[model samples]
Structure formats: structure tokens, C-alpha cells
Target: MSNFKITDIVGVIPALITPFDENENFDEGRMRNVVDFLIEEGVHGFYLTGSTGEGFLMTPDERKKVVKVVVDQVNGRVPVIAHIGAISTKISIDLAKDAYETGVDAISSVPPFYWKFKDNNIFKYYEDLSGSTPLPMIVYNVPLAGLFGFDFIKRLSTIENVKGIKYTAYTHQDIHKAKAQIGKDFMVYSGADEMAVSGLFNEADGIIGSFYSMLADVYVDIYNNIKAGEFSKAQIKQKIAVDIIEASLKYDYYAVIKAAMKWMGFDGGYVRRPFNNLSSCEEEKVKDEFRKIRDRYGVEDIRVLKSI
Candidate 1:
């Protein structure tokens, strides 16, 4: 077994959704249940408080609670990496330290997104974070919600404690360049659910995907088949996995993830404020599509299809 290496944490790492109660508070109990479910479903590890987890939406204390709950439930059974990025290094460092205190396997942080940071600022930010906590750190390189660009990754790689990165960008050149610069010791995780296979082929040690909780069996099967040299089955599994993502994208990304959680047994609910649930009209359409998947497997998925 690969223990605590960055590459060892690869494969089907679910960017878990933060469930909120109707009062718009995080449902900690439901969150624990969700972690248990993913562990049972065969996910490799957790990519907490990231894009899929709506990390930006929660308070620092609330986010820390999510990490603590997951680490407690997992209890050293699997790797649990908490996403610790914040609008400021103070907050990010706080979260990273908390993640260390909570017994998580590692901590990851996205570049500060307040303004377009210079390469030096970005480098200092990560180096500061990597130094702030004892836990291994993976830097997240994404400009969509921020200004840190490809050049930032190249520059940030200079930091010694910067363990690796989560590549969420769609550009293949960015992936190639990061791998080329970071070298084999620094792990690269595929952040796009739809590009897991391509990313894997392109040297993504594993995938950190939003869909892995509900669609985990498919990912596990795909990884297993591919490793077993069953390319045909792996391709078929990847196709189905992509089809599921295509369907989920029809609704809001996070909403559909929560919907999928309910469809399974985890009871993950709608996203908190500023990010709403799937519209009633869209929910029906999603239900029908989910049913198609469930009917084939003969499994009742409450995390994905709650009412049924």
C-alpha cells in the first residue's frame, strides 16, 4: 500500500459537496454520512472545500468543521485532504493548521483570488502556506475564479514544500507544462470530471472529481479494468461516466451534485446561499436521466435520486 505519498492519494477523489440545512446551515450529520458513503463506495480520498464543495461559500469555522467531521469518520482508513484556500493567507493558513489539527492526511490551497497577483506574490503565498503547517500541500492552479495563471504555476513550483497541484484548467498545454516543470515527485491530480481518462493518460496520477461520489462505481470499475488491461471495458466505463457528467451539467453543477447525493443514500442537500438548488422544472428532467442509470444497476440511489 502506498501510504501518504501524493501519488498514492490518486483515483476517484471526490470533491465533496457541502450540504446545507433548510436554515442555510451546514448539516454536519449529513456530511459524516456522506463521507462514510464515499469510503464505502470505493473513492480514493476526499478533495474537500474545493470547487465542488463550495469552499468559497462557507465561513472559516464551518469549513473547518466539514474537514474535522470527514477526518474523524475516515479515522485513518483513507487519505483525507482538506482544501484550505481563502481570500487571504491568514485565513488559508488558519484552515491549513486546523486541517493538520483535525488529523487529515494533507492540505491543499488555491492561489489567492482577491486580485491579479504577481508571480512573486503567488509564490510567497504558497511558500508561506506550505511553511505554516506541517501537512503536505498541493497548490491549486486555476484562473477562472482568480487571476493566478499558468506562469504562476511555473513560478510557484520553485517552492520546496509545494508538494504538487490540482490541474482544473482545460488547456492541455498547461497540464504538460506543469508536469514538465514539477517533475515526477510532485503529484498532479485531474480536477475535471469529464477529462479523468485524458488526464490519467497525460500523467494525472488520479482524479479529484465532483461526480465520483454518486458515479464512483463507474470510476472504480474503469480504473480497475484499465489496470487489469481491460481497455475495452475501461473505455465503455469512461463513456458512461462522461454521459453522466453531460446529464448533470444540464442543471447547476453543484445542485445536480447535491441532487445526486440525495438520490444515493448520503442525504447531501442543496447548495448554500448564492448557489441555489436545481429549478423544479430542471429537477424533473434530471430525475428522469438518473432513473435511466439506476434502472440499469437496479440500485436505489438516494444521494442521486432522493424521493425514489
Candidate 2:
């Protein structure tokens, strides 16, 4: 049998932020705490080493260390989806294999960037990575990366081990089109934190996002409240989440979140250099706004993951 398809595990999958210590080294202690915090905050699992985690910024070795820290902490309590995209297929394959050996539940990869490739090249990329390990692979489609569109996804999704997609942002129509093409059992994870409600409403099985670094419960509550048929509550929470995203963008996004993690006592450490730190000026404004997001979403300071 193929490794577990994503539907077997779903919801509030946070693309984790990489924690860095003063030396610009990966901070294992802080990384573990962040994983624990998300698990406790009702996040179902982790989507590691993505844009939020600065996966693109890290060396291959650093990426492996980050994945190891998370898998080691998660143990069996939650599923972990490791993102292994890099400039080379070899590095991506090695990372996918390493994550599988280290005990991650699944893996996803963004389409290769920098050197734009034809559909055939994207096809081969997924073919190679999925074949590299039995782990169910989700093709990450981030147009912002300038590497993806529907044709590429349709081609990649056919790989036997390729189970689904984690699309950066798509209209309900776009998802509908994908739904028709990918067919049953191939999960579609929503990438736009802003579009979670609409995606889940249209039947997306899960979510993979950078915003979940701080807004874990907001994402969860929106889904739970909707499934519970509490539409009013769900909409209110989603609005709060969007507001948080807006405020987060206003501040330095990573800086605001690293600061939030520290405030919550999770030791989220700091965003590595080249990403820069969130300015103290924006930080002051964001804290107040963040409090609003927390209150609006009905996420308690201490929470637990709902049984998936």
C-alpha cells in the first residue's frame, strides 16, 4: 500500500518557523517548544521547512536539523509533513529520505525555482522525489515562487506516491477544477490563510500555511466552528484571523511572530538574517492587535488539539 494519504490526517497543519539562536544556528530547544506549543494549541500537525520556516534560506544540513528537531519532539502524537524543496533534486530527495527515516508522517515540496523548467521537468521532479521514498508527497504550488500552475500539478499528481497538493492560493473555481482532475483520495490543502474558510467549506481536507506559526487556534476554530454548524462563530473567527494576518504583515511578519512566540513562552527564537527583524515600532502596535486576534478567535492561552 502507499504510505498514508493526507486525508488520513487533516487540518491546521502549520508550516513551522525555524528557530535560530544568536549564532544563527538552529535552536533545537526552541524548535521543540514551538512544536509542543502547536500541538497544545489544537494544531493537528506540522508542515515543516517551508517559507515560514525559511526553508529556502537554510543550507541542506540546517534543513535536516530542523526536521529532526520537529520529528523528535512530535513522536507519535501528531503527524509531521516535511517540505524538502531546494534548488536540486538530489538535495530534495535526500531531505525527503531523511525525514522518512527520522519519523515524519509525510512530505511536501514546492516546484523547483530559479531555473524555470518545462512541464516535463516539473513532472520528473515529483516523479523522482516520490519514488525516492514511500512517504505520501504533496506537490506544493506557490505561484509567488514563479514555478507552478495547473498543468504542472495535474502531471505531478499522477505519480503513484504523489497524494495531493498544497496550493498557495486558489479560487473556489480553481479548487473545483483541481477536484475534477485529481479525483478522490488526493487531498487538497489550502495555502492561503485568508482563504481557509472557503477552502474547507468547499471540502479541502487540510491546510498548510505559514500564518499558522502564531494563529494555530484561529485556523482550527474556524474549521471546527463551521463543522459544528456555527457559521456566525466561524466567520467571526476567520475575520479575526485575517485581521491578524494584516497586522502581522504591517509589522515585520516574522519578527511579529517570533516576538509572539517568545511572549507565549515557546522560545520561538528569531528569524534568521536577510529576513530582518520586526521593527520595535511595529511591534508595539501589533501586540495590541494580536490580543484582539486571540480574543476574537476563542483560542485560550492554554489549549489542546482536538482529536483528529
Candidate 3:
């Protein structure tokens, strides 16, 4: 297994977006550029093939390939956690094993969804996947998948090799409570980009979110400011991030994220089928708004709104 400790799982990890070419195939060159850019910008780690990476839309083979590419590209510069969660328990186990073979630092999974599964079913899913690989398991507690409350999270924490969680809910209180009740050794990464400061204030070990792919430097600043107890500085950076996120929310979330990446010079291509790209007019509007924010905040080196 990887030498990744639970402590290594902390910081500004991007829920990395998978780049696709015009044909909608995985764009390996773009992917490598993204990996390099984020690392250079000072991100802590990478969480691959999660919701932001379109894991659910990708086939099992595609997901495996993406994990291998990222693992190889990362080359141990930072820890990589591959989100191998699939609808089927067996598929998740298979993906976990593949991720392990490819040298990912850890594996994470959203509880099996679609069909209404009871708590016991979810527990069994985690139990089976955790045993299939030696890598540490980070539970993806996304409330949209169905809220995993403290009791359930506490129970999951008890499982063998289940090291931490990617807590995506807006409830910052749960993060503080989890740290208090689940123990500080249990790593909790805040998955909301807009609440990076609030999450840190509540004692979340780190921040992970979809937007971090485009704005790693901003979140890294937020993390460092929080760690340095520079709350005011962190809040200033957080406000800039919130403005960007709120602007994106005006359009389809994933589509705008991909477009913004392109505007930033990364060009992550379009969101997959069932997720449409922004119209030409919509794209121009987004570009204009980002330009305004960049000038307003005197932001530079962010790669966004550099030129209108």
C-alpha cells in the first residue's frame, strides 16, 4: 500500500475534474496539465473520479484508466484518493483493487444509491469494500446521496481501515461534532468550496470541492490563512471564492466549471452527456463576470479573468 497516513489526507484537495477531448474521450494531455497546474499552485492532494470527475457517467474500465493515469501523473508528489464508489458493491471492490494496484493512496465511496438501501445495506457495502483492499477507506458522506448522520458516520468509522470522511453537507456543526466525538485522529475534509472558511473554523481537517480544480491557489490560501489563525485574511479570500461560485450557480454547475477551467487556460472540455455545455452567450456572460471579480479584487495569477 501507499505510505499515506491519515494525517497526509488533510488540506486543499481538489475533487479533480476529468478532461475529455472533443470526441468526449479522456484527454490524457489535458489531464496531465491539470495535475501539474494544481500541484504547482500548491494543492495538498487529489481526489479522483468523484462526482466532479463524472465517475458515475464513466464506465468501470474508463474509471480504472483515469485512476491509473492520475496515479502515474501524480507520481507520489501528493497523496491521491480515487473515488471508486459504484452502484454495485462488487464493482466498488473491483475499482478499489484496481486503484490499489495503480498506487493510489486511498479509496473513497459514496454509499450505494438509486434503489433505496437501508442503513444495514450501506454498512455492508462499506464492510465489503473495506476488506477488499488494504488502502485506507474514506467514506463520502454526501447528504445528496442521503444524509449520513453522526450515528451512521460513527459506525462507519469503527470499520476496519475506514480512516476518514469527505463530509459534503452544509452542516458545519456536524464537522465539529465529528471531530469531538469521532476523535481528532479521524480525518474530516469539508467538501463545500463556498464554506471553506466556515468548515475550517469548525475544525475540519481540510477542504475538498469541485471548484478547487480551477482555483486551487485560492483554497490553498484559505487553508493556510485558517491554519495561521488569520481569520480576516481567510474570510477575504473566501468571499472572493464565494462570489465566483455564486456566479457559476447561475448556470449549470458542471458546465460552468468546465467552461471556467477553459477560460483559466486548462480547457477541461465539456461536461458529459445529460450535462450540456453553456451557450455562446452564456459563456460570454460568465467570462465578463469573472473579469469583473478579477479586477475588483485585484486578483492575479489565478488564471481566471486575466484578460476579459
Q: Could you say which candidate leads in lDDT? A: 3
- Clashing residue pairs for model 2: 42-305
> 34-96, model 2: which lDDT tens digit per residue?
888889888888888888898888998889888877877887788888999976899999998
Candidate 2 Cα deviation (angstroms), residue 241: 1.0
Candidate 3: regions farther than 4 A off: 295-301
Clashes of 3: 0
Deviating ranges (above 4 Å) for candidate 2? 1-5, 288-308
Candidate 1: lDDT of 55? Answer: 85
Candidate lDDT (C-alpha), each: 0.77, 0.78, 0.88
TM-score (all chains, Cα) for each model: 0.88, 0.90, 0.96
Model 1, 139-257: lDDT tens digits are 88665655346776767777777777888767756666667876877778877777777777677777787788777777777777766878787776677677768888876778887
The total number of steric clashes, by the backbone 3 Å criterion, in model 2 comes to 1
Off by over 4 Å in 1: 1-3, 146-152, 173-181, 291-308
How big is the positional error of residue 301 in model 1, measured in Å on the Cα after superposition? 12
